[model samples]
Structure formats: structure tokens, C-alpha cells
Target: MSESSDRLQRRSAPKRLTADDWADAALAALAERGLAAVAVEPLAARLGTTKGSFYWHFANRDALVAAALARWEEVSTERIIRAMETAEPDPAARLGALLRGATLSVVDDPLEVRLLAAGDHPEVAAALARVTERRIGYLAHLFELLGFPAPEARHRGFFAYTSYLGHAQVAHAVPGAVPTDPAYLAAVTAALLKR
Candidate 1:
């Protein structure tokens, strides 16, 4: 075989797909086509692989869905919270930053809206519940730091979270109406953080 043929053969060889790759593809499917779209065969086709590759990583479709939700929580919620904690030491500033980040763009965070829509599914419901509790708890802690009483802090936390959910839902519904301006985000952050 000539050198060019060898190079062409190497380029045509299949790339090995990992569990993360499957989970990521599943997430994209979930975001684009609801949770029902996340199937082994469809995802395998999307990845340009076979069902065998999926089975190599996950036991079944449910397992892949669970993995995708876990990955979403890790990257979207946990990672963002960690970054905020590190970047903003002041509780007020941290809360403002969190609100600003949450309201950044509805289109940019379609996965969140998709997950909310899939909340009827057992695994999706459980994952949503866990994420909701975690986010509320963190926001409550920040409120406490800002000197609010425990009950009040919890109330404020719920308010903030619900506001975010409402905004996300609206944005998803009418993508064009949702403002992406920094001033709009700042105004939202101020309103949410107001005692």
C-alpha cells in the first residue's frame, strides 16, 4: 500500500467512543427532542457508531438516560456553583453573579427547559428534584450570609429559583422576546436579590 492509501485508511477507521461520549450525545438528544428521543439505536446513529458501542458503556437506555442526567447535573449545576463560590467570596456578590448567570440566555440553556419538560419521567423527576433542592439550599445559605433569618432565607431561595424557572419557561416559549442584554440581566439580578 502507498503512503497516501495508508493515511486514507487511518482517517476512515472508526474512532472509539467512550461512555462520556454516549452520555453527551444522549444529553444533546434530550435537549433537542425531549427525553423520548434518547434511545440506543438513535444515539448510536447520531454518533456514527453501532448499538454495540452503546452496550459497551451502558447496560440499557435507562442507564444511558441516568448517566446523561448525572452528567448534566455535574456540569451545569455543581460546576457553576463551585465556580461562583470560588470567584465571588462575598455572599451578596455571589448571589448576584448566580442570578446573572442563570438569566444569561434562555436559548443558550435549552437543556434546562428540556429537563423541566421531561420532569414527568421517573428518573428525570428525581434528578430535577435533587437539583432543585441543591440549588435552593445553596441560595438559602447565601441569604443567611446576607443576614436573613432561616425561614426567610429559605423563602427567598425558593423565590429566586422559581423566578429562574419562570424566566426559562418564558424564554423557551418565545425565544425572540427574551432579552439577552447585560442591562436586562443586571436588572433581574437586582430585583431577585432585593430583600
Candidate 2:
């Protein structure tokens, strides 16, 4: 090795990356580069670290993937669920507020927009489908409690749920899409709530 190379190698510090670091990098990679680009080397590079640090923090790639999903569930789904649950005594109002807040937040996530646009990430696809299903179920229950028949409640809930997904796509796709705007979102949502 050249003198400078030898000196640089000798001067390298020991790796000290933690699990949270790896998870953060992994999440960013998933949201930005799509899942395929999130291998150990790239994530380590994104972290300004190395693969050794990743292996130390994660058992393998799957573990990292699980961690990323868990983090999303914690911050996104769980938080929204809590907010809606606590919003009010009225289910419609509470769910509406939650959906409105969610739409607004999702509008700001360009990375999420791109990731969904790319159509990769089977894991996220499956997980989000489940999340959507649960949300639809919640809507159904709420409508039922509001005095609608079960079938009608489910029908309206499905309509609202699907509309939200479509609106989310538009919000992420159109250059100036802002379906998340509170007043606009309320108007759109109020229109959809009709059976």
C-alpha cells in the first residue's frame, strides 16, 4: 500500500453505529430509493458508516425491513388510530378529523409519494392493504353506531376508504396536488361520506 493509504487505514476509527441509526437510514432508503436499493452497503453509506455497523445492529436484511415497518406502524398508523379514537364522542366527527389530519401529513411526504408511485415493496404493499382493511372496518363500525344498517355502513365505508386512497394518489402525483388541505379535504370527505 502507498504511505497515505496505509496511514488512512491505520487512522480509521472503530464502528459505533446503533440500531436506531440503521433503522433511520433504512426507512429513508425505502422512502427515497425504493426497497431494492436498501441493501447493507448502500444503507451504511447513507449513514456515513459501513456494512459492519449494519450487521452489528441488524441480524440481516429482513430484520431491518421489519424494523422499518414497525417504525411506520408506530408513527403513522398507531398515532392516527389514537388521534381518531380520542377525537370526540361522535365516531363520524372523530374519524373525519383523523382522516383529515392524515391526508395533510401524507401530502408533505414526497418520498412516500415517490415510493408508492414506483409500485415496488411487496411487503409494504401487503402491510398497507391490511391497514386499509382495518380502517374500513373501523369506518363500518362507526357508521353502524350512527344508525345505519350493516350493509349500508360497509358500502359507505368502502366508498370512503377507496376515495381516500385515490385522493392520496392524486395528492402525491399532481404537481400541485393538495387534497390534504384542511378545508378542501373536509369538503372532499364530506362529499364522499354520502352513501
Among the numbered candidates, top TM-score falls to: 1
lDDT of 1 by residue, 55-95 (tens): 89988899999999999889888998999989999998899
**lDDT minimum window of 10 residues, candidate 1:** 100-109
> Per-prediction RMSD in angstroms?
2.4, 7.0
Candidate number of the best lDDT: 1
List the candidate 1 regions with Cα displacement exceeding 4 Å. Answer: 1-13
- Stretches of candidate 2 exceeding 4 Å from the true structure: 1-21, 111-122
- TM-score for all models, in order of appearance: 0.89, 0.75
lDDT of 2 by residue, 125-191 (tens): 7656666677788878878877889998898778777776676678766846654457887776677
Q: What is the lDDT of residue 116 in candidate 1?
A: 92
